[model samples]
Target chain A: MKSLIIGIVAGILCTFSFIPQVAKIIRTKHTKDLSLITFSALSLGVFLWLIYGLMIKEFPVIAANAVTLILSLTIVMMKIKHG
Target chain B: MKSLIIGIVAGILCTFSFIPQVAKIIRTKHTKDLSLITFSALSLGVFLWLIYGLMIKEFPVIAANAVTLILSLTIVMMKIKHG
Candidate 1:
């Protein structure tokens, strides 16, 4: 039970870390300063995590990485759109 | 052995995902678009992961999260310096 709670907290903190950045990007419509390489790498990394999670059958890992993939990919798309 | 390899691969992908961004930041020295909140949250999250890794006595988890914390914290510092 404790371990599960810890996992959830860690997952939430890490995955949701991008929320503020996403909000800022949407509000400002500026992404020239954001590195495409960084966001792209992040999306790829999260995608790999999603796969790993699936392989291990870990729901928290899967859910967190899935949401992270969406958020990171959104940043990548916005960078492309505003680039 | 397969599970260990998976963990290593996932850890590498997720933690090293910041390398490109760090390199770009060093070269271009632009960080105005990167959100303070995002990096701060990332640092906190990674720190939590480190603690969790320690608690669980997981070497790979500890090492990966430690490296990630350093990289993410570097970005945070750079953002401050260039903000």
Candidate 2:
């Protein structure tokens, strides 16, 4: 139970890290300073985490990475379009 | 062997995700669009990951999150100073 709670808290904290960038990009419609390379690497990392979660059959990892992947991918796409 | 390799790869990938943002902030000397809230959350997340790694006795997680924390913290500081 403690580990689960810890995992959830960690998940929420880490996942929310990208929100500001996302919100900024959405509002400004600009990502000139953001890099494609970085976002690409991040998206790939999130994908791997998703796979790792599946391999380990861990629901928290799976769910967190899934949402993170979507959000990261969205930022990547926006950066590409607007950068 | 594969799991170890996979873990290392995932660690590197995820760790590198923030590099671009860090580089950009350093280069541009601007972070007006970046949010303090997001960076704080991210730094905290990295710290938690470091603690989790310590608790689990996982070197990979420890090493990765340590580097990530340093990099992310650098950006946060820069953003605060320059934003």
The numbered model that scores best in TM-score is 1
lDDT by residue for model 1 (B9-71), tens: 767877888988888899999998999999898898888888888888889889989999999
Residue A74 error, candidate 2, Å: 0.7
Docking class of 2: medium
Kindly list the per-residue Cα lDDT of model 2 for residues A1-83, writing each as its tens digit.
Answer: 56546556777999878888799888888677666887899899988888887887888878989988998898889988887
Name the DockQ score for candidate 1: 0.63
lDDT of model 2 at position A3: 55
Interface RMSD of each: 1.8, 2.0
Candidate with top DockQ is 1
List candidate 2 stretches off by more than 4 Å. Answer: A1-4, B1-4
Question: For candidate 2 chain A, which ten residues in a row score worst on lDDT?
Answer: A1-10
User: Residue A68's C-alpha lDDT in candidate 1?
Assistant: 92
lDDT of the candidates, in the order given:
0.87, 0.82
lDDT of 2 by residue, B1-83 (tens): 56556556777998988888888888888777666777789899888888887877888878988999998899889877987
Error of 2 at A8 (Å): 2.7
